[model samples]
Target: MSTPAAAAVSSADGVAWDLADLYAGPADPQLDADIARAGERATEFRNRYEGRVAELDAPAMRDALAELEDLSQLADRPLIFAHLLHAADSSDPANGALVARTAEANSQVRAGLLFFELEWLALPDDHTEPIITDPAAGRFAHFLRKGLAFRPHVLDRPVEEALEQKSNTGSRAFKRLFDEITSGLECDVELPSGPQRLNESATLALLHDHDREVRRAAARALTVTLRSNSKVLTYIFNVLLQDHNVDDQLRSRGHPMQARNLANEISQESVDALIDACAGANGMVQRYYRLKTRLLGLEKLYDYDRYAPLEQQDGRWSWDRCRQMVTDSYAAFDPRAGEVVEMFFEHSWIDAELRNGKRGGAFSAGGPADAHPYILCNYTDRARDVMTVAHELGHGIHQYLARDVGYLQSHTPLTMAETASVFGEMIVFYRLLEGSRDAGERLSLLAGKIEDSFATVFRQIVLTQFERAAHAARRSEGELSTERIGELWMDANAPMHGDVVELTPDYESWWSYIPHFIHTPFYTYAYSFGHLLVLALYATYRRQGPDFVPGYLEMLRRGGSASPRDLVAPLGVDLDDPRLWQRGLALIGDMIDEAEALAAGRD
Candidate 1:
C-alpha cells in the first residue's frame, strides 16, 4: 500500500537511533543500577541538606547545587530512556511499564528533594541576595535566582511531596493513556489502490497530497477515527483540564497561563503582547490562502486544501539528500553548527523512520548531559521533510552546545527553546528558495515557508486560545462534551482563515488528536514566541551577516543560565518590545508579498 512518495523515501527506514549511550536496552543492568544509586543519593541528600538550605553559606550552597545537578542527571537518565522508548512504540506493554516505573522513580526522587527548595524559599531576600550574587555560587546563581520566582507558589514540604507522589496515578496516567491511544490509531483511507490503513502521522501527512480526492479521503479517514475515539479523548481532556485547574488553585495563579508564563521566565503581559501581535496579523493568513485558492483554480478552499501543493511535480528528497542539504545549510551559516549537525548522523543520534507505533510530530530531547541529545522525527521524503530535519537538527545543535552549562541549567524555557530550531529552518528554507529553478518553484517555496510560519505563529495562537476557552469552559460549565469542545476548536480556528477556507463538520473532531492539550496545557504559545523571536533574530543575522554568528552561538551556550531577556540582549534584540514581535510579523507579510508577485509572473 506504499505510495510512490513512500517508496521513494525508504532510505529513512533504516535510520533508527542508537540509544546505547544511555543503556543497551530495557534489560541493561546499568539502568537499575543508576536508578537505585539515584535513590540512595536522594536519601543522603535529604539527610544532609533537607533542613539546612537557609543556613548554608555561598560555598556550601555551591556544593549543594553541584550535588543536586548530579542527582538530577542520574534520575533523568532512566526516565528519558523510557520516554524515548515509549515514544518509539507505546504499543509494547513493557515500554509502557518502563515509562510508569521510571516516572514513579523520578517522582520519588523529586519528592524526597522537596524540602530543599521549600527551605530555600523560606530565606529572606536580604539573606538570599548576597549568596545569589557570590561568584562562588558560579552558574548556580541563576539557578537559585530562578527558584525565588516560585516562592509565592511553594507549598508545605509534606503537601508538595504528596502531590508529586499522587501525580503518577493521576495526571501522568491520563497523559500516558492519551499517548497510547492516539499513537496506535489507524485511519482507513480509500486510496486509488484501495483501502489502506495508515498510522496517525502518515494519515495526517496525506493532507498535503497533490490529489484533491486523496486529500479529501485522508481528511474523512482522520475524522472517522477521531470520532470513534472522541469519548475517551474528550474525557482525557476534561480530566487534565480539571487537574490543571486544581493545580492553578493550589499554586494561586490568577489565569490559566500565569504559571506557564512564570515557568517560561516571561510575564503575562509579554505573552499577551505576542498573542496580540500574531492575532492582529491574521489578515495575512486569509490573504495567503485566498491566493492559494486562485493558484489551485478552486472555487472554494477547505481545511484539507490549505496544504495542497501548487503543482503536481512536488520535490522529494531521500534521507541522504536531506542530510546533506541540512548540514550544508548549517555549515554555510556557521562551520561549528554544521559539524554538530553532521555528528548527529555520523553517530546514531537521530530516529527518523516510519514505524507502526511511532509517535507523531518531532522533538529534540536533551537526554543526559553525560551522553548527548536525541532527535525523533518521521521523514516522509517531502520537501517539508527536509526542513523538518533542519529544524530538529537546529535543536540538536542547541542541546549539544548547551551541555557545558550542566544538566539543571542547560535546557532553555519553552519560549526561547524554539529560537535555534526556527532559525535553522529559515536558513534551509532560504537556501531552497534561492536555488529554485523557475518562477513556479519560487512561488511554491515561498508559499510553503509562509504556511510553515503561520503554523508556528498564527495557528499556535489559535491553539492557545482554544486551550484558554476549554480551560475556562471546564471551570464554568463542568466537563465539556465532545461536541462542545469541537465548537470551541472551530471558533478559535475560524477567525484565522476567515472566509477563505471552508471548515467542514469533519474538521470538528480534529482537535482531539493533538497531544499538546492533554500533555502540556498552554504549551502552544511557546511556538509563537520562539518563531517571532527567531524571525527578528534572523533579521539581525541578515543585517550583520558574519558578526551575528558568535553572539548567537554564545546565547545558546549560556542556555537557561540567565533570563531570556538577558540571554538575547547581547544579540541586539529586546524581548519586551511589542514592536519587535511586529517586526517578525512584517517579515511574514513580506513573504506573502513576494509570493503574490511570483504568482503574477513578476519575479
Candidate 2:
C-alpha cells in the first residue's frame, strides 16, 4: 500500500491539468471578465435571433449555429475547469462552491440560448435542408440530430425556461445533498495500524486485504455508517424520484428508463437484450467464484473474498514501470494509439495519485475541443492501478482525436464512451498475459483480468437490476426502508453469484456504498455494455491484428456524430444481436476454462 505522504506527492507531482488553458484559474482577472462577456453574448444572441429564426435562410441559419457554438465554447471552458477541479478533490469546500456557482452560471447561459435551438427545430425540413447542405453545418450534424430527437419533448420557451430554473433546486440540489451526506460518513475500522477513519474508497480497498478480519470489519463499518445515514439518503431518493416522475410526465415519456435510453441514444430493446444476456451468464460467474474459493483455500467463500488478492502477494509496480507497460502494450497493437497515450505521461496531463480529500475512483474529464482532456485517479502502484491508467488514457486519446469535430459532436454518448477505455485495458492486459514466463504469474494475470471483466460486466448488471428494483418499488409504493433496500440488493446479487459465494447478511447493505446509485441511476448497465463490446472487439483484434486499428480509430473519430450501430458496423460488429453479446460471454467462459485446467494440472 502507498503511504499517505507518497500519495500526496503523487497528487502534486504532475501539473494537475492546466485548466488555466481554459482560463488562467478561478482567480484570474480574465476569467472574471469572460463570465461577464458571456452574459453579454447571450443577450446579443437572443436579441439577434430569438424570434426571427423562421425568416433566416440557409446561410443565416448556418451562421446562427456557428455563433451559438462560439458562445457555448466560451461559456463551457470555465464551467468545465471548475467542475473538473471540484471532482478531482470534492473534500475541498472551495472547489465544491466553485462547482455550484459555475453550474448556476452555465444554466443561466443555457436558458438564454434555449430559444435558438427551439426555434431552429421548429423550422420545416425543407427550410433546414439547405442549412444541412452547407459545409459549415457539417460539424453541427450531431447537434441537429440531437435537437430533432428531442423535438417531441421540447416545450415552449417559457415552459423550458421554468424547467431549467427549477432544475438547480430540484434534482441537482438533491444530488449534491446525497453526495455530501455519503462522503461525510467516516467509517472507524480497526486495522493492523489501529483504528482509523475510512472514507468509502478506503473502506473498499480493505475488501482486497488478505486478512478476512479486515474485510469483515470494513463491511460492518460500511453497514453501520449507511444505516445511520439512511433517512437522509431516503429523502434524497424520494426528492430525485419525484423530480424525475414530474419531468417524465411533463415530457410525455413512457417510462423513466425511456428518457435515459433517449439520452444514451440507444434503443430500449438493445438494453433489454444486454440485460438478458448478462442474466444468462450468472452460472459462469458462479463457476469463477467457485474457483476463487478453492484458490483462496476458504471453507466457504464470503462476498468480501471476491476481490481478495491471489496468495497475499505484495507485488507493486512503480509508476514508471506502469507507464512503460501500458505504452508498450498500446504500441504493440497500434503505434498511433501508443503515441497518443504517451503524451499523457510525457506532458504531465494525468493526476494519478491517492490522497485524502481527493475524490475516489478514476475518471477522464475536460476535453472540450479547445483543451486537452485531463484524467484524475487515485493510483497506488497496484497492477489494477496500471489497468486504470490505461483505461483512463484510452478516454483521453479518444477525446483528443474527437476534439477535431468541435465540442457538441465530440462528446460521445455514455454507452459508446466506454469502448475505447475498456479496449485500452484489454490491450495492456493481453500484452502482459503473453509476456508471462511462469504458470503462477500467468494464472494471476488471467485471474485478475477476468475478475475485472466480471466486475465491469456482471457486477454492474446486478447494480442496474438493483436500481431498477429500488426505483420500481419506490414508485409503486413510497420510500423504501433501509432493510427494504438491502433486501432488494440481495435479490439482485443472489442469482448473480449463485451458491459459490455466500451472501452474508451484512453484504446486502453493500449497495449503500455504491456512489453510482446516487450519482447516476441505471448508468451501471453502460459499463456492462461497454465491457462486452470491448471483449468482443478485442477478440476480433486478436484474430485480425493490426488491421483492426484503423476501423477502431474511425469509430472514435465519429464520436457522437454516429449511432452505436453505425459506428461498429464498419468493423462488422452488431450490438443489436444477442449473439454478439454471447460471443463476449463465451470469451469469458474460455478464460474460466483455462483457469480451471491450469489449477487441475497444478493439483
Candidate 3:
C-alpha cells in the first residue's frame, strides 16, 4: 500500500523547492534580518505617507505603492514559512514561537499601513476617480472597489487601532484556545488488532479503513471525544459569533453574510443560486449512495461508508509511479500545464510526506507574488494523492500566470481560487477514463471522480446549510447545546445522503470539527461554486479544443482584478444564470448514470 514514508519528498529532473530559498533553516540569520527590516520599512512608510495620501500625484502614489508591495513581499517569506512549519509540526515549541513572533511583527506592519487606504477613501471622488482611471491604477480597480465597500465599516482611526490591538486578546485568543484543545485530544478506539489512541490525522484516516467495524469505532470515538468537550466548543462558538455580531452591528452590516460576500467580491445572488442548485441535486447524491450500497453489498450505507475505498484490497501506487501518472495526465491535457506540474516535481516545491505532528490534509500556499507557489500534502501514494498533486500544481501554475499582474492584483478571492485546481482534477480524470481499456477500471475511476465531486459540491452545500441554521438558531435561541447542534447537522445532511446511508447517531458531533465554520462562516459554498463552474468550463473546453486555453489563462490572469461575473463572461459563461449550476450538476448526474450502466452490464 502507499505508505507515508514514500511521499516524503518529490524528485523531478533533479530540482526541488529549496524552501531554503525562504530561510536556510528556521533560525537562519536572513529571517531575523528580514523581520527587523520589515518593521523599519513599516515605520518609514507611516512617517512618509500616512496622512498625505490625497496630496500625492500619480507617480508619487505609484512609488509609495511599490515600496509597500516590496515590504509585503519581504514579509511574506517569513510569515508563510513560519505558518507552514508550524502546521507541519504543531507540537514543536520552537516553530510555535516563530509563528507567534512573525504574527506580531506582521500585525504591527499592517497597522502602520491602515491609514493608506483609509486616507485614500477620505479623498473626494474627483481626486480618487482620476487616479483610478489612470492605466497604472486600472489593475487595482478591484482592490479600490474592495476598500470602498468597507468604507462604512471603517471606524475612526483611533477606534480601529484600538480594536486591532485588542483583537489578539479577544477573538484571536479564543481561536488559539480552540485549536489547542481540538488538536490535542486523543481518542481511544478499538481497532481490529487492539485499542489505540487516535490523533487528529489518524481519526480521519479511519474513514478510509477497509474494515467496517474499524471505521465505525473510529466514528464513535470521535463523536464521544467531541461530545465530552462540547461545552468548551460551544463557548468558542459563542465568543466568535458574538464577536462577529458586535462588529457587524458597529459597521451597520445589513446581514451576517454581507461582510463575507463583500470580502469574497461575489454577489449574494450568485451564492444563493449555487446553493439552490446543489440542493436540487440532493437526489443525485442520494442516488449515488444507493449505487454505492449495492456495490458494497450492504442494505444501507452509513456515514462512515461515504469515503470507503471503491476497491478495498487494491494495491497502493508507489510514490514514483504516482508522480509519473499525474505528470502524464497533465501532459495529455496541455503541454503548458504539464510543464508547470513537472516544475513542481523537479523543484521540491511539494512536501508530500506524512509524519507525526504534521498537519492533516493538503493546501497550496500562494508564495510571494514574485516567487513560486508552494504545496504541502500528507500524500499516501493513493489515486487520491496523485489527483491532489494535479490539483495543487494547478494552483501553482495559476499563481505563476497571475504574478504578471503585479502584487496588488495577483491575489484571487477565495471564491474563484479553486477554479484551476478543480479543472486540473477534471483533466486528469478524463485522461484516465479514456486510457483505461477495461470497463471495471473505467467504472472505478468514474466512481472515484463522482465521489470527489459529491464531496466538494454536495458536502460543502450541506456544511453551508448547517452553518446558516446554526448561526440563526444561536442568535434567536441563545447558545446551542451539543445535542441541538448535532440535530442541526443531521437536518442538513440526512436528507442529502438519503435512506441508502444510515447516519450513526453520534455523527451529530461531526459539526464541531469543521474549521471552516469557525474560521470563515458560510465559506463552504465557494467549493461547490468552483466545482460546478469548472465542470462547465471543462465541458466547454472539450467542445472548443485549443481555443479554450487562452480564455482559461485569461480568467486566471485577471486574479482579483474583476468580479466573478466579468471573469467568466469572456468565456460566455454567466454566473447569474441558475441554469449554469444545474448544467454542472447534470454533468455529474450523467457520470453517475454511466457508472450505474457499467455496473448493470457487469451483473
Candidate 4:
C-alpha cells in the first residue's frame, strides 16, 4: 500500500486497534502456547503423512487437508500478532525479535508440511484428479487444482524445505532491515509554522498541502534524506534482486515474472496484454498532466507537484465521520457489505492512530479463517482520508465474507484482492459526487478521483516496468548501483509524463521507498489489475443496477477458491479482452475531460 505519498499521516489525531481480541501483547502466554501447539501438530502430521500422499484415498486426503488447515490457523495467530506489533512500531527491538521468532517458527512448521505439496506434485493426474473432483471435498478441489499450478516450479522436498528454512534468516531478515531503516528516518523541513521534524509518513503528507512552498520543502526534504541513505538502500535492493533471480533460475522459471504469474494462477499471455495495454494508454496520462499544469499555474509539473491538491476544501473529517461515511456508503450498496464494515468498527478491528514509529502506507490483513480482518492506516482528517477509510473497509468486508471458505481457499490472488477495496472506494466517491451541490466541490471530488486513478492504474503499471528493467539489468549487468537503478527507474517513468511533467533525478531515489520491489517482485501490476477489473465491474453495476449486487457478492465470497479467470467469468468479465482495460483507462480519461471542462468554466 506504499504510494508516491505516504498513506500514514493525519491532520486529525488518534484511534489505535485493540489487539486484545487476538492477544494483549507478544507477552501473552496464549500466543506462546499456540505456537507450541502448532509445532507439535506439524511434527505429528509430517510423521503420519510424509511419503504417503499417493497412497491416501479421497476420504483420508480430506482429513489430511483439514489437519493442515488447523495447523495453519494455529501458526497464524502468533504470526499475525507479531506482524501487528512490528507494524505499530518497527523500531522496538522486542517487536523485531518476536517478528523474527514468529517467522522462524512459521517457516519450520511450513517446512514440515512441505512434503505434502511435493508429493502431491509427484502424484500422477490419474491418481489425484478423482480425489479433488469429489463434490464432498468442497472448495478444497479448487485449492488443489491451484496448487498443481506450481508443479513445474516445485523442487524436491529437501530442496523446498531448505529454501523455506533459509528464507527466515535470508529474505525475512532483509525485510526487517528495510522496515527498520525506513521507519527510523526523519525529515527536517521548514514550514510557515517554523522548523519542524517529521517521520516519513508525516513529511510526505506535507507534499499535498495547498502551499506550494510547503510542498517544495517537503519534496526537497524527502529527496535529500533518501539520497543520503541511498548507499544502504541500494545494497538492499541488489541483494534482494539477486536472491530472487537465483531462486527463479534454480526453479527453471522462464523469466522473472513466470513465478508470479504461476502463483497468481494466471496465464503469461494475459499479463503481457495487460502491461502492453496500459503502456499504450499512458498517453492519456500525459494528456491529464498537461491539464494539471494549467490548473497548478505551473509551466511544468515537477514530481513534487504531481499529487498537489488542485484546491483545498476547508474543514476536516473527524474519525467518527470517517467511519460513518464509509459504513453508510457500503450499506447503500448492499446491507451485507455494510455488515462487515460495521463489524470492523464495532469490534476494534482497525488501527487508525497516528504514531511516531509506525510504518508508512495502508493495508487490510486477514487473520485465521474464523477471525476478523484487521486494517492498518494512518488517518489524517483530509478528504482523501475518507476515501482511504472506504477503500480498506472494502478489503475488510471481502476478507470477512471469504473467511468461511476455509484458510487455503479464502486468500485471493493479488489481482482479485483489490476488487473489494477499490469498489468500496467507488461507492463512497460517487456518494460524495452526488451530494455536492456546487461545481467547486464537484471539481474537487473529480480531481481527487482522477488523481487516485492515475496512481493506482497508470503509475503502478509504470512501476511494474521499472521492476522488470531493474531485475533484468541486475541479472545481466551484475549488481546495479544507486545511480544505475535510479536511471532504470527514470527511464521507465519519463515516458508516461512525456513533456507535460518533469521526472527529475531526485525523483529517481523515490523508487527506493517502495516496499513492493523488495517484498514482491513484479507485484505492482496487481494494483493495475485490480483497479481495471473493478472499473469494468463497476460499469456493469451502473448498467445492470441491483442485478449486479448478487453476482458481485458471489464473486467476493468465492475468494481464492477459484482462479481469477474462473472467479470473474461467472460475473461476465472477459479478462483477456484488451477492450476491458481500455474501457477502464477511458473512465479515467473521462474524468480528466470533466476536470478540464470545469477548469475552463472557472476561468
Best by lDDT: 1
TM-score of predicted model 3? 0.93
Task: Kindly list the per-residue Cα lDDT of model 4 for residues 289-357, writing each as its tens digit.
Answer: 888788778887888888788776554778888888888889999998888899888888888877777
Clashing pairs in 2: none
lDDT of each: 0.90, 0.79, 0.78, 0.85
lDDT of 1 by residue, 1-603 (tens): 443122213469989899999999999999999999999999999999877787899999999989999999999899999999999888899999999999999999999998888899999999999999999999889999998999998788889999999999999999999999987888888877687878777787888889999999999988999999999999999999999999989988888898888889998888888888888889999999999999998999999998899979857788999999999999999999989999999998999998877888899999778899999998888888888889899899989999999999999998888889999999999898889999988988998899999999999999999999999999999999999999999999998999999999999998999988988789999999999899999998999999999999999998889999999999998887769988999999999999999888842
Better of 2 and 4 by TM-score: 4
1-603: candidate 3 lDDT, tens digit per residue:
222221223222232245775778898999989989998988888998877998887667777777877888886678888877776667677887887788777777777778887898787778877776676664565666666767777878777777766776788667766766665666677777777775655666677766889888889878888888889998898778778878888888877888878888877887887888788778998888888888888887889988777666654666688778889877777787788788887878877765556555677888777677888776654677678777887787888778877777787877788888899888888888888888888888898899899989999999988887877787788877777888899999976887777888888888887777777787888888889999999999999998888888888877777887888899989877778988999999999999999999888
The deviation in Å at residue 229 for candidate 1 is 0.5
TM-score of each: 0.98, 0.94, 0.93, 0.97
Across 418-449, the per-residue lDDT of candidate 2 in tens digits comes to: 99999999988888988988888888888898
Q: Is candidate 2 or candidate 3 better by TM-score?
A: 2
Residue 179 alpha-carbon offset, candidate 3, angstroms: 3.7
Q: Pick the candidate with the highest TM-score.
A: 1
Which residue ranges in model 3 land beyond 4 Å of their true spot? 1-18, 182-189, 196-198, 228-231
- Model 4 reaches what TM-score against the true structure? 0.97
Model 1 residue 470 distance off true place after TM-score fit, in angstroms: 0.3
